[model samples]
Target: MGEWRRCCDNAVCGDNAVCWKSDGVKLKLQGENIQPANENEDLKKGCYNYGVDIADAIVPEWKELWVQVEPEAECIWFGEQEASKKPNGWWSFTFRNYLGKSVIRIKLADGREVVTDPIEVVSPKTPLDEQCDPLFYPKFLRTLIDDLIRYLVSLPFDWEAPTEFATEERTQPPSPIFVLHVLAQHADTICYALQTIWRNPHRRLVTEERWVLLSEASSVDADTILMMLHYPEHLRPYRGNSLSTLAQRLKSKVPERVFERRVTETLDTPENRFIKRFMDIVLYWCDELKRLGYWEKAKSHQPKLEDLQNFVRFLRADPLFADVSELTIFPASSQVLQKRDGYRECLQIYRLLHIARAPIFDRLQDAIDNRRIDQLYEFWCFFRLAETLAAVLGDGQRPYFSTLESDEGGLRRDLSANLGNGYQLVYNEQFEPIWKPKARKKLSYSVPLRPDISLLQENRLLVVFDAKFRFDEKDIQPNQPLEDEMDKAQQEGEIERLAKHADICKMHTYRDALKCRASVILFPGTKGAFHCTNGTKKDNPCLLDIVQNNGLKGVGAVPFVPKPEK
Candidate 1:
């Protein structure tokens, strides 16, 4: 008899898949058991010459795959395409301290390989933590532009395609403007992503400075700038990752066209022209003020050149002004220029922008960026989901809405189910027009997950919006105590009951679950700041944390007071 033997009784069955290692024999034959030939086999191929199958790798999808391991097992290296690297394989099954079964996932992939399950051994179980940031990153935010260029330039897609930008060298001085020319079909995605980022409570987008003002419009306020500069860490999933809401919106509400009608043409009535002209005046004044400041006594100390360049580019392209007012560089008479004031001096710059792009003001400028891209994406997901949302909701513009008896009107159907974060989950798009009156009557929910708000947008997409409100100890009205400790403990029973609703919406995962759309939460606002929520699944993470605006129709804020440069 050899030193190792088969621990499991072969007498049990023929060519079975179970192999216990206490026999200390792997790949080696023991005793007179007479097992199959070629005891040692290539693990990756999943079979030994003797039909002994070992599933070493698996295709790691949403439903996690696992491999079992004994306290001491053979080297099961988990590398993607090739067995070149070892992440946990190096530890060599000595992970008892990690727990009884330690499960690790193969993140990326190799097509032919399945990150399958049940290796010859199973370790302890460990909770996997998400590693990436939930917020929209600059690189990711710019991906559409970069990816679009790559996609277009590489039309052939094969090796014959161009490897560099098509604009390289051919276009002189590289147009300062970043133009993304995509198929109109895909235009919604760009706008959708923009709105998503803008609505992210954690995001602070990069935008132009609108210092000019028409009589009706004032200089872009500090609150507006601040709104553009912030984004959230995570956001709820909406319309099942489709920006159709945005697309549908653009279809009927072409912002650019709307702005043109509202700003340029007297569609130009007396009130409008007065309003527009006043903006003209304000713009001229702002420009003059900036230009004056450029040469101000303090100019010697700061980065005025960079500031000047920004101001120049802004005035030239600002959507606020419809024409290059003769006031800016033309050095208009005192009547037009008025007393050279503060930022009001730059008002003349408004004239230049108006003449060039009056018709497409909203195109270059967003309502969210009307110094804000937003219908509010945070708790709701997708700032102005627009047409896509309508499409998702199908024809039912007002779908059903569901909430908990304990909760009131905001988005979070039941806030506690979502991890401390108030927003999470996205539902199907078919449940419309109205939700079952929050009675004990179970509506359409077939799954174990219940979203925050279940309603309809555009009548096609079943919409869900969960609201998250974060209040600091300081911000709570002066009367409320920060910690109502005694009440919280007692409230647990009620909170748990509230959380059971999570099960209500989970059953909607029909064969075609893709249609089972939803948005987890709707953020009204938080601490007078922004709000955000991460989606239920890992794949569709929030674009960013802080939604770009203050849960308003667009992302804007009214500063209580203004201070020069804190």
Candidate 2:
């Protein structure tokens, strides 16, 4: 809404690079239904909001970006590649727009990079406030992550199995480094669990017997020495003469006594040592967070850096831990840590951390930083579909996995969860031309086809769903005018902007090629409609109705918007 101005404070430049000019490249956002940049009041000073939909902003397509660079700059870089300067002192490029924030950088020949303000691209379906509000997107994502961790823990997963890092695959759950971000997000919970256990930490009485000189001994346990001397007379012969000889030697020269000490409520128990190890891990994570720039990103949320440091400091300064040595090994046999109140809670946190450490749970920071909402939305839909099927149908066995590589050199993962009554839900399972197994009864006649979601009954493909992060208003709005009302040029222009037809064709391709009963399009919209075989439908059917009643007999689209439950 306001005139574009240079805001140098918000922009970040390389430490070694000179801050020559912050706003070296001027950007003009050109499109229809463009909202005011300041709609997200919390937006940074140099950031601008660009809307994609001319009318309906559901799906994103390439958009024009006109840039004017300062004449002094020898080179300009949009992202990693250098931009080609035009003859008119301007540069133009088409950006594949999506809902998230991205920055533009201009690198000078003098090794100085001029980082400009970020650009916040908003999808037509996304509300500006929800996209920018920390409480909305960030909190919702955290909740989803928490739910995922809970679900993963409940299943009998092979947590220690070897798994490779997440490549550029859209289907891999997450990267291993994302575990650090998950910890950062739940840092507050970690602190609370730590503090609670530290106050009333598990302790056990330790009893020990030490041999000391008679003059130095405070209290002697004669029974302990007497017990050693009282071994059965017949059994002593087999034990050996060395024990008897040593006992007699001890009595004559050194005259030592056995001093038995009973120390009560000692904090040096295995459980307490386990707690100390957890603290050490957390301390190490704090340093990792700083190194990865996670601490800076997490400043807006709870359990601040100072809070975490103080919690560690408080634990270390306590005298109770003075005798507790560093944990050399995990106390796998300790039942107290697994079942006790405060200790059990800490163990649960540790389990979550352990589960998160696997090189899965895909690009979460990108979702948080608005680097890629499309991928994030796809993941959300995958989980949502799985949850919906499991709840509607009955719960089945734990998930099974299959892996393959995409033609694009990315890993393609297929994870399937069983739903009772013979239904199975799968994510990113490919329908290939040559399939020895895993495809069950269905196979693609041509190239491989991978849908975002697939529902199978008795190992037979029944229905497929493809998640699209975009939507056109023409498909969702009610009481639309006839196409004849618009001129030929106007209709052509509208056709060029909307993607509903192309999406429908893709669904048709999946349904026909895979020989599935139905295919559906899942998008972030407010309405869902079904187009059935029996053309007698009076109105559109609800998404649930299609899944439960219609048996997914037809192709259609549904609104699967990401909103937190009340």
Candidate 3:
């Protein structure tokens, strides 16, 4: 014990405390945490040391209290009992309400700091089989981002730069937006295509048997002279007083005579022009990625961007393109780009670039790189719901409104679509109308609550939905009688437990206050079709009943996940 204490002299200590070294920290998952028995053991430790859904709370267990964490996170805190030293004198903290990927540095009181591995916080209802494999979360995140991009692109809205006569609110602004993610996604294919084109570029025969002065000739040869026979004008220059004299002079002066050459050139071909145009686009994106501060936020993507830039630089300076003119016209319809080996890959690159230039995708990489899985899920749900409603309710005639506004808090986006059949879908907009409310008109009467989505039929509120990235069966389960002991246990002031049922309770508020036909909670989970009659204490099994009877009453939860189309 004496030797151990002497060796641990550098460890952090409290008043009269025994010197201790932290034996590493472990996260204890609580509150609807999913634990699969067959979870892969290989993922037990590393960058992703522990996995928890956004809804789950994790308690961090460490050996000492003097060991602090740097950049204190808002989501972590200590409960009353946890704040005080335990019977064994161990201090603790909990990751109560947090989402996204994050890491912390443990700063011991002894002035030593150690950075921990990354922790992944994903959506509770993520459709991927994360219970047994946490690695699936990244793949799921990518798929969700793609769906969001597709959704935004599908909106029937055109962007125009705001002019002096147009107000910023009324006129959409044109901004120079580059889609770096698209280039990164197709980086491999673009590099390979450039290489193939460099090795075997299409060449065209520019000139046929053109004569050049002997002094300017690279080398004199018999073929060079023989080719000049096709051009009799050149023979005229060497003609003498007699044919024999001319022939003798031609033979003797063959080494000094004018040379005729047939030229095959690579520059100025359709294939080379197409490559030049592609290089310009790639280089533009590479420059934009750095200028827009994207590289600083996510350093991992920097290497790929650099590689793409360097390869384009090499292609531009290649000997084959030494005389290639700048691209004034793109050979978009040329057969060389569509059929040739190396140039064919450029076609694929063009397709990817088209997808990458989607509207509102400029901010997508920020969400992805920051590991904002919850926001990604919300975007996917918003678009999926809109598409589903359009399909079921008939295609939209025109957008009721669409706006993307920027302020000190960043961009604020709202979209509304008129579904032709007297149905309209609105996103992230206020409930009240611009004008005075009519009798029986559905609008927020008290504090305005803007649900994520609202459906209106013939200018009357039909229903409202809020996309929730979290769900726990325990919170939605029917209330059951509890014994005295259990009842007392519930009263111990568990704040997390108290808020678990807040989402469903808020749904009731939306139904009652907004006076909508139905208020539904859309979440990514298996808890489907949890139906209940509005203002009823008893649980009802039918939402169709409320809708069919033309009653202003229905509340429930619906499960939603954006699956790929068949």
Candidate 4:
């Protein structure tokens, strides 16, 4: 018998003893469907093994099976088999650094071929708390609201009563009724201020002329001769002749009638006065707000106030505002006020300020007092997660998040990113609604499986996270034999060893029912670390760890601790 014959059994060479047969042969691959490992590991350290099984029932001669892997882009396979040996119908191979799906191909000695189902490799990236700071989200939101408030407060409120109307002449007697026209006056001020803010600097060329008497005549114009004759007594003698005849005696002898003319020029505008006054008013308002303790009362608002102050300074330094006249008060009329765009904008700003201030103030105060942080907490988590995804994916692959109301009246939010590949990542999607048994009598009701966060690739759920807002420490003791403890604890009535067990159990339920590769409970902790645990163990019920086997199921906890005060 050849070496190939030594590897044959009754299973491979049953009826055809002379020829190798491949009739009832099939290839099978087996491994834990779910593989859990750190993302930073390289191919060699991260790779796992899958057993290859060849089932041949009726061949007497040795048969060979050649194995291959398909779609070589995502992964590389090692230990490719061309085995004639049965060896209990199994062999093993390793796959390294693989994600997504790969198919296994088997070729028999008799030129027949078979293929196995696409093997899925699941690798979930670990989430870091530092990437999504809990405090930054709320602070960012508050700053936006505060900026709106500051802008609203900066609008001019005082209006100048129109003392004279453009339609009425100066000769026309002042309106005997003395109408105030408050709206028009206010509108005009707003229009003027906005125009001043937005308009370019005004400039004009100015020329000034002056004349001076000189001892010599540089160039004699008609005016120079007239001046010399009119002031004759002031002239001195030239070339030994009387000053009166010097003009006739000498052509250009230090001519007693000399003239000097200078034309001076400048560029000037009225905008500088306006800009200075406007800056003064802005500074005054800032000082008043500070003096009144508005920013101090809500310290979180100080950053916005400082930003507004800096913007005011920027406006003050702008050359465009240099020529605008300082407007102590605004003048307006009913017709002019309606026609001006700036007036309309100012009115809109005023309305917006009035509408936004009260609600935002109340909401912010509630957040600071911790009276309404529950809703804020949920929002913060959602915002942070979305931001983190966008940061990681970059502009080309940034995801968008949207909130929808489910039929059951619960809000559902999802973040979706298209990788441009065949796959996509959809996070925070709720499971389909279903009706399950609630009582022994077979009564059932709709139950929606809503995880706080879920990551899905194509149709497969990669992982799920539940945000829990409570301490997860359990009171159970480890290493104590249950029999001894049961007797001692029962006599002492100490049966509360399962504290906080429900949290881990709930996580397990999510993992099993959702059919996700892993489920994690995100809770608040001091150290911001990840702990994994298995639900089957009775001891250390709250302990969390990573478990990847039999389809990659795991239950774990990670902390999203709050930022400390500076």
Top-lDDT structure, candidate number:
2
Ranking according to lDDT, highest score first: 2, 3, 4, 1
Tens-place lDDT digits, model 3, residues 1-566? 01111112224322222221234432221222322212423322221432222211111222122222223222222321223223332334344444465443444445545434343444434433443332245445545654665444334442322551222231322222225545655667788888988887888878556456656776546877566564445553344444456467555223334655566654678668778877887787677756754433334455665787899888877778877787777676788888898788887666545532234444445555555766677667666766666666655443433443432223445556666577777776565533444422337767667888888777877788887666554556536532333444358644344444666678888888788888877765545555546445333333333333264356776666655322
Alpha carbon deviation, residue 519, candidate 4 (Å): 1.3
Encode model 2's per-residue lDDT on 464-504: one tens digit a residue: 98888765435543243423323342566544334545566
Badly placed stretches (over 4 Å) of model 3 are 1-93, 105-117, 122-143, 149-157, 160-279, 282-363, 396-401, 404-412, 432-442, 480-490, 530-552, 564-566
TM-score of each: 0.18, 0.58, 0.49, 0.32
lDDT head-to-head 1 vs 3, winner: 3
Per-model root-mean-square deviation over C-alphas:
31.2, 11.4, 12.6, 27.8
Give candidate 2 regions above 4 Å deviation. Answer: 1-36, 39-61, 72-85, 127-274, 280-320, 326-360, 395-415, 435-442, 473-500, 534-538, 549-552, 562-566
Best of the two (3, 4) by TM-score: 3
lDDT of 1 at 437: 61
Q: Once superposed on the true structure, which residue ranges of model 1 sit more than 4 Å away at CA?
A: 1-381, 384-458, 467-488, 491-566
Q: For candidate 1, lDDT tens digit of each residue in 1-566?
A: 12222335456433322332322222211222222213423222222211222232211111122223333233333332122233532221121111111123222222221222232221111001211211111111122222222222222111111442211112121111111111111223323322332233121123443323222343434553343234221122334334456445434221111101122221212222332453344344335534532112222222433343344344435443343233222333433233323212233222322222221112222211211111112212321222123333234332211222222422222211111112312332133212446533233444323443343322322334443211121221223332443245237633322222222223223212324333333322222222122322232223222121121121111111111121
lDDT (Cα, tens digit) per residue for candidate 4, span 1-566? 11111123336534222211123543332232222122213321212211111111111111122222221112222224233322444443443322223444455455545444343322222111122333322332233233323322331221112452122113322111011111112334533555554563334456333344563334456766666656555565456544535556444243443554534332233333434554555455556556633444334344555655666667666665554556654332333333444434443333322221132223333443332333334434444443444444335443442223333533222344443222334444556534543321111123456676665544556667766544243312234554555556557643333223455566767777776677776554433323334444332223223321232346666554434233
Q: Is candidate 1 or candidate 2 better by lDDT?
A: 2
Task: Looking at model 1, report the run of 10 residues with the lowest lDDT sum.
Answer: 554-563
lDDT of 2: 0.56
